[model samples]
Target: MTCRLCKRDCQLKNSHIIPEFLYRSLYDEKHRFYRISVEESEKSTFIQKGVREYLLCGDCEQRLSKYERYASTVLQGGVELTVSRDGNLIHIEGIDYVKFKLFSLSILWRSSISSLDIFKQVSLGPHEEKLRKMILAEDAGRDCEYPFIMSPITHEGALQKDLIIQPTKTKLEGHVVYRFTFGGIFWVFVVSGHRIPSVVVSASISTNGKLTMLPREITEMKYISNMATELARKGKV
Candidate 1:
């Protein structure tokens, strides 16, 4: 198969659409993987591993791994989260703008091209080819292009252990958006439009190589949980 990212006619590796480390918290004591349903009619399901596909060659896989390592560190709290006095915002500093930017784009681009049902909600349309060229050329583009904002998912009592929700698509301010949860964090990727809000601008990876975490609302958690319930049920049936 031709490597999707590099377009090389070589053996493609089973590349994870989302990095594996993002699913570590979803593993059980016995190392089983459990995922919740986004449909109300069905319950959760168990699996051994995350979603992967024969997408990239070894070289492209390694290239993405470098950014994944850095993102893993940030997600694992290796970087300090500086809280504001009002507690509405948290800042993460010293991120590599280019690497993290490419990482985010890679996730979107991969999901857009993936055949897996989980990523069906993400279709980059004409932007898919544009992003492919960017990844091929190692171009992170401007921060305003495909800007993203992130928030950590907080459970009230017990964590929703070993759960992975499919990506959901929506629109915001006339821009197409895709939202997903992994590594206990919710990532919202805005694939279209250039006029990012001030709040999102502040949290951009290109903004002085730092990111900000805004508090997730109660309704947002409920919506995500509902979506997970539906996806789980659909996957099972």
Candidate 2:
């Protein structure tokens, strides 16, 4: 089997689309794993672990793990970030732009190559090969390329925990956008033909290595809640 990222004709390893640690907060007291589907029928699946694919070779997997470790620290709030709250927006500072940028790109690239149904919305088309090469070379690319914005899902209580919303692709302001929820975080990745706007870039980890976290509102929570309800109705809970 050839490695998807490095194009190496080596034995492929079981690679996780999303890092395993990200799912830690989603487990029940009995250590069971639950998965929810967002299709019209609203199906639910239970498992003991995160989704995996036979994609990368051992070397490539290790390479991606480097970025994942850094990302885990950031997501776990292990790193010191200068945080400020103004109304609904939270501004964060002291981020390592290069590392986080690569981490975000890695997630996007991984989803593009994944065969899992939940990640089906992330076909990169012509951009697929480009991103593969970038990841292989450890190139994060320019800030304007594949820029992204992030927000933490603030839904309280057990009902909203460990929920995974399938990735949805759309166009926003003429640029291609992909939105998905995972590990209590909502991420919006923009595929722009032109350089991303200065304002958007500023908000990204691209400039000055800073970050800003926006709060998810009622409408967003409603969407997840509705999905949960469907799953419950189907006896998937």
Candidate 3:
């Protein structure tokens, strides 16, 4: 198929319906995230500006394949918490558990007031409620900045993740990280000032810096709107 964004005769990249960075930075204290205080926007400029080209295709992804390998360390493991009976009538916990939370965020989900307002917009609504339901499976972290969510799934592919903060705003407001996971499908949120182009090329390189997989999946999901409305509610203090 042709590229989705460019509509060219080439492959495309797996665009996170949200953005990957929103979750990837949770465990990584080094991503350097920034938040513009709702109160300080009038007096101060942005401390860290977001990237222009956040997501990419193989043509774009090749520019940073080595970074994907480091992500494995952040993809924490999971444990099945359900009780099942075997042929011998022995109670056993299923092994289909995943650690961490799946990642996502709306680049379009930014706040109109200030960076701080962004938090308020997300934390105080039905969105936060859904975010809470999803994250109930993870931890609150040391400062409770990182959000986490969990849900027991049957035998199937699931994802676990943590979001490290990439400070693009202030030196005082360090990065905020969180964890939220789910069953089936990988979701990535790139919290940025840019918007998704609806199409692009993407390729994957091995952890050893080798070109491995070139993904052209037209990344789309049905639960994103529902999840966003839910997750937005989670940003509340």
Candidate 4:
């Protein structure tokens, strides 16, 4: 494959739907449902494939995949981040942590904008409202179990989110707040459409060798790729 952005003989690249490391044990580690109301689909066809992609070659994926552990301490609680798209910037809002939790909490996707949602059957774990609050407050060092929350931060969204993260105190539970800073994928999803193609899940190749059902990550690179192709078609990422 050719590089989706540079078109320089695209090689497989590291595709991060959301970095695996940031969530730590908090990771879902399993499948779940996220629901999206049909308000955004009135004008287009709904994508049936999962959303996500590979921006790395096999070797690159292997190398970058190991870095997730280094940044586990960067995010916690509700977060608000933003992604500024050039042409891909559709109508959207600044990041909202509460909305992110709501969107990510359940994994059902529906055309209805109400409580109609579902997920694959599964067991459960203890609630982490306290841990969630700790992460928001940026208090990882107090545990001594995991430290060094810097160094491996990754970029996200069209604006290249790593460029815009700053620390702020945000409320998570009642009277509970987190002090974590925003970096990497922090604000990108907040600005993207939740009612539309809300939560991106996975990415993979189509049988025809083209990429399909890609999440916001692959779509970002491919959006740039598609634009360049159009320029050749239009003589003009």
Candidate 5:
């Protein structure tokens, strides 16, 4: 099969749909993680590795890994990046607008193109090809083009950093949104052609390389709380 990202008829490598770094904290002492499903019919199970498939070739994988590496460093505070907190809102500065933005877009694009069951809901339709061209050309585009709002998942005033839930699709401010939670952060990407709310655009990565993360509690979201409870009941959390 042709490599999905580069579209070249070359040997495709086992590429992770979601960057492996995001799953590092989710692993257990035995080097395993629980795959929880909110649906009652689908029982939660344990997995030894992150989701992967033959999507990209060696060159394309390396190309995307650069962005992921940068993002992981910033997220893990490996760099001397300044992070400030005000009340419940957290602000991070000194980010590379291009690299960070591309990383976010890559997540959306990869999840959409992935055949993994966890990402089956991410059908981007026309936006899929558009994102492909943008990523291939290293065009992050305007922040408003595919704006995303982020929030840290907190339960009882503590951050939840060890769970990976199924991505969900919803509508926010009349814009289509896809929500993903992993590595203690909840990312909500707004995908639509119509005018997006300015409030939503401002929540995304700024052109000046500033990013904000608002805190959201699990108690406020019934679905997440239910899933957490189910996962805890079945496996070591």
Candidate 6:
């Protein structure tokens, strides 16, 4: 079979649609994580690993893994970041722009190309090819091309880890965006050909290795609250 990322005819590896490290915090005592899906009648389920498919060859997998490793370090606090706060907003600096930006783009591109049911909500259409080329060239592209907003989520004052939600796509400020939750962080990836919203651009990681995160509680998000309520009603959480 041909590899998806490099388009090479070779033996493909079981590549994860979402990097494996993202699921580490979600693992339970049995080394599994609960996957919650509002669209499914089951509501909640357990899995030993993140979603995977035969997408890339060993070489291509390693290439993408490099970016994933960098991202894991940053997200897991392995990298030194200069941090300051203004109200609830947290500004962070000292990031590797190329590595982190490519990592973010890789996730978006992978989800769009993935055939998994969980990622069905993400379909990049024409943007898919553009991203493929960019990733292949290791071009992070401009900040506004595929901007994303990230916020760490909390439940009542406590950081909420151990939860993974199915991605959902929606329109925000006249742009297409996909929402994902994992590692106690909410990600809103804006994928559009037109000019992205200023809010998204400002929140996205800057070329100077700066980023802003809006720390939020679950109660402020009605959709998340509703999902929690439904899961509780089903005795799943």
Local distance difference test scores for all models: 0.77, 0.78, 0.28, 0.27, 0.86, 0.87
Candidate 5's TM-score:
0.91
* Off by more than 4 A, model 5: 39-43, 226-237
- Model 3, 21-78: lDDT tens digits are 4344332255543432324223323223233332334653442332232233332333
lDDT of 3: 0.28
Give the runs in model 4 whose Cα sits over 4 Å from its true position: 4-14, 21-30, 35-39, 42-50, 73-237
Q: Please state the error at residue 160 of candidate 2 in Å.
A: 5.8
Best by lDDT: 6
Best by TM-score: 6
Clashing pairs in 5: none
Regions of candidate 6 where Cα sits further than 4 Å from its true position = 39-44, 230-237
Q: How do the candidates rank by TM-score, highest first?
A: 6, 5, 2, 1, 4, 3
Clashing pairs in 6: none
Poorest lDDT segment (10 consecutive residues) of candidate 5: 228-237
Give the TM-score of each candidate: 0.85, 0.88, 0.20, 0.24, 0.91, 0.93
lDDT of 2 by residue, 111-136 (tens): 98998888998988878888888888
- For model 4, residues 85-124, the per-residue Cα lDDT tens digits are 3353222233232222322221111111112121111111
Task: Name the Cα RMSD for model 1.
Answer: 3.3
TM-score, structure 3 vs. true: 0.20
lDDT at residue 213 of model 3 (Cα atoms): 17
* Clashes (N, CA, C under 3 Å) per candidate: 13, 0, 60, 32, 0, 0
* lDDT per residue as tens, model 5, 1-237: 788777999989999888999988988899888776655567768888899988999999998999999999877767767789988778888899889889988989999999877898999999999998898899899988998888888888888888677888988878889999877888999999999999888879988888888989877877687676876775534
